[model samples]
Target: MANDKNNGQDNLRNAKASASNMYEEGKAGASKMYEEGKASASNMYDEGKDRVNQVYEQGKEKAEEIYKQTKEKASEIYEESMKKVSEAQENLKEYSDELVKTVKEKPLTSLLIAGGIGFIISALLKK
Candidate 1:
């Protein structure tokens, strides 16, 4: 009976030791998995940030290109408008010169035409 009790005590002690070892191994494995998961999450976050930054840079560059294009187009339009205005001014000056020359060359005919136009305008105003 004494030997049987000693055997039972030894078995119990061995079982307890085995259970403790299994618990320690499980804890170590869980800690390792947690660390790996944290590292993976950090890597994913960094990659996401890098992608966002790259997209932001591309957008900024595109906006700058658009702005430059718009500025060039506006400049071209302004130049075209100025050129048209200058042409119109030149045309007006030429017309004025022609009229002055005609008036000087044919003063009597111009006076007769002006008088006829005045008579027509006064008649319309009366109606």
Candidate 2:
């Protein structure tokens, strides 16, 4: 009976030591996982920052290109409008001169045509 009791006590002690060792191992594994997670998160943040900078540079370059194109288009439109305005002014001057000559040479004929047209329009409206 004495020997059996001593063996049992030894077995209980071994079991406790094994349990303590397992607890230590589990704690170490958890700490290692936490460190690895922290490192992975930091690397991801750095990669994201780099991508954002690249996108910003691309957007700025595109905006400058668009501005240059818009300025050139506006200049072309202004030149075309000025050219058209000059042509219209020249045509108006020629028409004005011709009108003055016609009025001077055919005053009575112009008046008679105008009165006849007015009388015809009035007669049609009355009917």
Candidate 3:
């Protein structure tokens, strides 16, 4: 009977020790998982932030490039318009000079033509 009691006590002590070891191992594993999850979350956040920054930089560069191209095209158009205006002014001057020379050479003919044009304009105005 004494041996049996001692053996039973030893079995109970072994079971208790096994339960304690299992509990400790479970706690340690849970702690390790929590730390690993936190590290993974932090790494993901950093990667996302870096990706956003890279996209922003690329967008900014594209916008600047477009702006420069637009500015250059506008400058070229302005120059072309100025050249056309200068050419028109020169043509107008030449036409005026030619008309003046014709008037000086034939004053009576010019006067008659001018009188006819004035009559036509006045007639249109009355209508």
Candidate 3 pairs with clashing backbones: none
* Residue pairs with backbone overlap in model 1: none
Question: What TM-score does model 3 achieve against the real structure?
Answer: 0.72
Candidate 1, which ten residues in sequence have the lowest lDDT sum?
94-103
**Candidate 1 lDDT over residue span 11-116, tens digit each:** 9999999999999999999999999999999999999999999999999999999999999999999999999999999999999999999999999999999999
Residues 1-127 of candidate 2: C-alpha lDDT, one tens digit per residue: 9999999999999999999999999999999999999999999999999999999999999999999999999999999999999999999999999988887899998789889999999999999
Candidate ranking under lDDT, highest first, comes to: 3, 1, 2
lDDT of 2: 0.95
lDDT tens per residue, model 3, 74-102: 99999999999999999999999999999
**CA lDDT, every model vs. true structure:** 0.99, 0.95, 1.00
After TM-score superposition, the amount by which residue 8's alpha carbon in candidate 1 deviates from its true location, in angstroms, is 2.5
The window of 10 residues in a row where model 2 has the poorest summed lDDT is: 95-104
User: Model 2: runs farther than 4 Å from truth?
Assistant: 109-127
